[model samples]
Target chain A: MKQFFIFVKKEFFHIWRDRRTLLILFGMPIMQVMIFGFALTNEVKNSKIGILDLSKDEATAKLSERISASQYFDLVENLKSSSDIDASFRKGDTKMVIIFPEHFRESLLHSNSVQVQLIADASDPNTATTLINYASAIINDYQDELMGETKLPYTITTQTRMLYNPQQKGAYNFVPGVMAMILMLVCTMMTSIAIVKEKETGTMEVLLVSPLKPIMVILAKAVPYLLLSIVNIISILLLSVYVLDVPIAGSLALLMFTSILFIITSLSLGLLISSFTASQQTAMLISLMGLFMPTLLFSGFMFPIENMPIPMQVISNLVPAKWYYYIVKSVMIKGLGIEAIWREVLILTGMTVFLLTVSIKKYNVRLA
Target chain B: MTDEKVITAKALTKKFADFIAVNAISFEVSKGEIFGFLGANGAGKTTAMRMLCGLSLPTSGEATVAGFDVYKESEKIKKNIGYMSQKFSLYEDLTVKENMRFYGGIYGLTEKRIKEKSQQVLADLHMEAEQNKLVKSLPLGWKQKLAFSVAIFHEPAIVFLDEPTGGVDPVTRREFWEMIYQAAQNGTTVFVTTHYMDEAEYCNRVSIMVDGRIEALDTPTNLKKQFNTASMDEVFLQLARKAVRQAD
Candidate 1:
């Protein structure tokens, strides 16, 4: 253990001496949180929404068809009943579910008006509001098309219901996203590169010639990165609270516990990558392409996992970042406790164990 | 040479899948002897040294280092041996003193011993004033010397040097040999590999390997007389000319 602490101290020196690593560890997290939170929050494209047409009328069909035809929305599901709308929203496949009242076309013809309820999952309020505006515009276009045919003017009213977050001040989505991204970058990418640098420089062989165990070498290497990631998490949280005006609505202890778990998971991934490649460049490229890309694309952060096809959704479950993002969203944004995110925590723990076992086994085989 | 043996190998071998890296070669070195391991490129000198240093496993061999078995007691062997590779293994980002302290700590030295010995080592290298400087700022010869010093800082029984003086100037190489001679004089067995036959003259006994087998083993003067040559270079060339394996 004395040796382990020495190894850990040496690792700190390596990181402290390199300015680029310091830049990535401290500078990038604040940049991502502030930039994505304040500046890049208003992008909505290819939103997959569900249609619950209670009327099943010609007007409802025409309106649903018009909404689907627009480039901004992809009609993923035809939700059967009112009950299924909650399931679709919880599954996150549907951003907004449009419900049409019964006899909409007949009511419009007889009464000259109809109510179309737009239930948007306001977990991400920016996307939710933008999608509602797009749907309302499509309905207005349909109303004008009807007015062109008939001499009388028809009216379509849209009642927008923002679910789960009616008056929330802590519903910023980028906090969790930036956390996942920065952890993966600092823990996974930097740790892998550091280990591979030893191999490339041949210091690893020299250390192996000593009395130090291989597991101890890596465990010591991982501790510094783990601490560095915690520093990064603190910075991101501070920026989100002060600059972005987002509050942590749940237990701070639980938030930190989950972040540390995710950090360990990322470090295990780094050890696995280091075992596969010898050169620093190859390790870095593998971490970027194999780990970072998948985390960014599948973590339900920048892009919705439900918007992807079925196979991609299955693959997303294998990424530890996906589960971490879910847990952070539950605790940070939804103000839910462990009861709401126990399964996600369990999955992250399982991924960390599996990665650590495989990487250690491979490292031993190489040395043996 | 002393009667006590520090290293002994009998039919030691290492095979990687279909390729035989180091086939059934054996030798023994007594304590306090400078043993030279000579080979051309791809001749398995490094591979054999790796197995003995516990950095790699021998496919089939009966070897002991410092009275510890190479197979089951490899970790014990590691504790008693120090190694420096062709690539300089010191942490270039660390200061000269920090590198020494770290190596000393990993070797299970006490805190007072680490501090005192590191200071002593710095003074011995005439680098006390430069102890706080990062290793990267030093010249190549100083870096090489510091790496060699760090390897044996804990005074292990046997120090393995794998081409430790591959690319230094002649003066620096002479100084490096002086360090090796001093270590051996202090009763630390030196097992080194190099292609420079001139450096081979400094070893008490030398073994020349070609294509995974030791082709010759003797004192440098005996090798010259046996090959009917005046210099150790001609003796090595006469034996290495019959090789078929290409340099890796």
Candidate 2:
């Protein structure tokens, strides 16, 4: 126990001595969280749209007023002619344009049908889809109110209800994903780089030659990162809950335990990388290119695995972060227990064991 | 007195696939002696030292360090030995006193013992005033000396130094030898490896390795007389040339 404390103290000294590394470790996570939370949002609001209302009638005027009043469209301009639509969109001021035909009110009143065109810029597919859906919903609601008195046969009304994330706040999804990502980055990548740094600096030889066993040295190096990862997990959870209003609906203790398990798995993977690479730079590149990208892209963090291409969907199963993300989402969002996420938990456990075994084997072989 | 051999190796060999780093060789060093393992770069000096320190395993040999079997009792051997590398293995960010305390602590020394020994070690090196300063702030010579002192702080049975004085001034190297002599006087065996032929003269006895084999094993004076050379460097050159001729 005394030896362990001494080792942990040495690890803390290494961290405290490197001020720049400490800053990058703590600051990057919060910065990424705030940036992803606020800057990149899925909810469409105040989207600028141009209206070309050719019909000088009460119906067209009312429809224009409704479009302008809705929060989704800002009604940036009212163009005079169809040629003006091209110029306005070219300026990039409007994301979409609504065109009303000349006999729109007459056609609607006499024949109960009118043609209106909604043109959306498809450069950003997600934003374009959101704007079109918002506009369509407002128009549909208006038509339903207008024809309230007329009873029609085979009338169908659709009520959409979102489960778990009712508000569809991006923070709800990102807070959990960011927590997993940051933990993996700090615990796994940093630990691997630290070990490789020792190798590069030749300090690893000194430690190995000392009276300390190789396994004990590795354990000592990992203990501080494990503790720091736990602390980061708590900080992220607190920030998400208090600052962003993202709740942990399940038991906090269970979430903490599972997060620790994932952090250990990440650290084990880092050790494996360190064992393979002789230089810190190589270890860092491997961790980032080989681990970080896959964790971010295929771990169900940004893109849903179910919606991915078949090969990519298959690759997602190989990333440990995918299992961790599933566990966190299940516990935090769905309020589920170990019984619900036991499969993911078991997979993570198995990966941790496999990585740790391989690293130990490699380390022994190198020593021999 | 027959049991005074601190290290014993018989037909010790280490090979990495087809490359024989340290071929089958045997040697022994008595307790309280400064034994120098001399060689050029890639001459298997480091490979042999690593095996003796229990950091690496011998391929096919029987070796014991400080009365512990190298194969089955490496951990016991480690606990009885101290190691200082050519890299000057001390934490640069830590203070002199902190480095000593840390190593002592890791070796399972009590806090009181660490404090007492750290003070004594610092005082012995005339570095009492510099204890609070970070190691990185010190001169290279002082760091090397401090690293050597810290490695043997626990007064282990044997301290293995893999070229402990690689890039230091001659004056500091001389002072470092004095410390090694003091440790030897205190009944601690010193097993050191070095490329500097002059530094090998400071050892009680030295072994010259060429082409992964020990070409000469004797005192510096005896080696010079045996090879009919003026200095250890000329003796080493002659042996290396002879080995090359044999290989051709």
Candidate 3:
């Protein structure tokens, strides 16, 4: 509509005129991608590795306990059989699958040796290799302790099998996380603050009193943000692929489609925050505290969700950013298709719809 | 013209939970009269105006603006009315011309009409040379005038001004009243709410609200005579002291 265009044009003027906004919109995404991609991480903590204990003996039980107890890895899934490891790896749920052969205690006592196979989901080669080394060292320590006491000779072997990411580039992990964080900051935080600024300046009343419908006003406000978020996505993708050398394994179209859903989810969240806040300062604080902290702490962008406490893992389910991070990981790093990520897409879409509905209901044309 | 009422209300009310913001009250305004809405800080002047402007729903009662029902035909009412708030509502980041262009565009003004009207308004304000300047750079008086002009740019049947001259000098306020008088002379009804008692003298009729109800409604001369006061200020003080609710 002509009125919608006029509203959008006015919004553009507001955004363009503010230098701080221009800096935040364009500067922050690139800086976040480059800084997080190249600089932040090397130590792997809370790697989700599955454990399959074929021998229900004291030794394997002790081994599982010690592996999980170690600071480096969190034993996320306990597999029933060898058949489940491949599916778990493809799901990107588990980084490594440690399997103990049947009759390991008997075989170790009878032949002085036992075989243990370590299957690493090489999608993140760095993490996979580190997990294998940690597991191997733990086993060697246990074997050495046995040798220290008894005169009998015994040996344990660790076989490492790497999966999707053969190169173990650290950029793989950082790329997905940076994308999620930057999109969330730009879309959610920025939109909330912008809308609240109108409320602060008292221009929102004038807008509401205009002939333009409230829904149309909200749509026009969101359009510029949607376009800006897309631009941010493209810029992050370029930096990740070209500068950081992170590969895009899946279809770029599908990646973009998923990003659009995530952006909408974030925008709805921002609108919801704006509706609750009376001023720009309150909106900014709530967005940073509500969105930024949770996305950073619980979304598995900075830390693995499986490694978090049970309550935290449950809470992370409510954050749209967690699902977006998983989707990015599956499509970009694991090279998985839509069939593998349909549930995440559904969740993001559902969150978007729910947030948008609540915000629309909450957005009052009347001044409080 | 007095027989042709533009705004008619009967027992209009608004309640927020247990608290009644605007208790049952009613009044009527002529088609081209300047109606001054005066009240203490928490006297519910804004609440009543909000309901009438189609921005809020009343808990009970019926009202019509510009011949359209306030409840069901709010969109129609919106198209026929204009509003300006206490905080001057111009986009400070935008140039003077752009602000006019934007308001004109949203009010359904055609491109040529917008250009011509923008020019005419700028010339009328003697601000044609300052059209390209950002509104924030202008003085408070100019911003207030520009905001008022934009509100009635569409020539709505009624224009509601909420404390339009709050922080301006007396000379500017006088000039601003001249503009309102000119608009009313051209057959545009003005419904304005202000804290300043002197501005009430400029209105054709004035209503003073106290504690969610209109305590007095009459011409400024009659209000002064009835209260046994020499000035509108003394008359306001005598009525305002009876307020049951504290200023919010």
Q: Write the per-residue lDDT of candidate 1 for residues A1-368, one digit (tens) a residue.
A: 99999889999999899988788789888878877875533345678889999899888988898899988888899988999988998896778899998899999999999999999878776677768878999999889888889978799999889887674233337789889988998899898999999999999998888899998999998999999899999888888888876899999999999999999999999999999999999998999999889988889876777667899999999989999999999999889999999999999999999999999999999887
lDDT of 3 by residue, A288-346 (tens): 88889999887776666766779988999999989999999999988999999999999
**Residue A316, model 1, lDDT:** 97
Instruction: Estimate, for each residue in B86-196, the C-alpha lDDT of model 3 and write its tens digit.
Output: 987999999999999999999899999999988889989999889999999999999999999999999999999999999899999999999999888888899999888
Model 2, span A202-301: residue lDDT tens: 7888788776778888988999899888778877787777766668988888898889889999999999999989998899899899989998898877
Summarize candidate 1's per-residue lDDT along B152-206 as a digit string, tens digits: 9999999999999978999999999999999999999999999888999999999
Which stretches of model 2 miss by more than 4 angstroms? A40-172, A249-251, A304-308, A334-340, B1-3, B244-248
The best-first sequence of candidates by lDDT reads 1, 3, 2
lDDT of 2 by residue, B139-168 (tens): 999999888888888889999988888889
Every candidate's TM-score, chain A alone: 0.69, 0.71, 0.67
lDDT for each of the candidates? 0.90, 0.83, 0.88
Error of 2 at A248 (Å): 3.2
Better of 1 and 2 by lDDT: 1
The best candidate in terms of lDDT = 1
Ranking 1 against 2 by DockQ, winner:
2
Arrange candidates by DockQ, descending: 2, 1, 3
Q: Judge the docking of candidate 3 as incorrect, acceptable, medium or high.
A: medium
Which window of 10 residues has the lowest lDDT sum in candidate 1 chain A?
A165-174
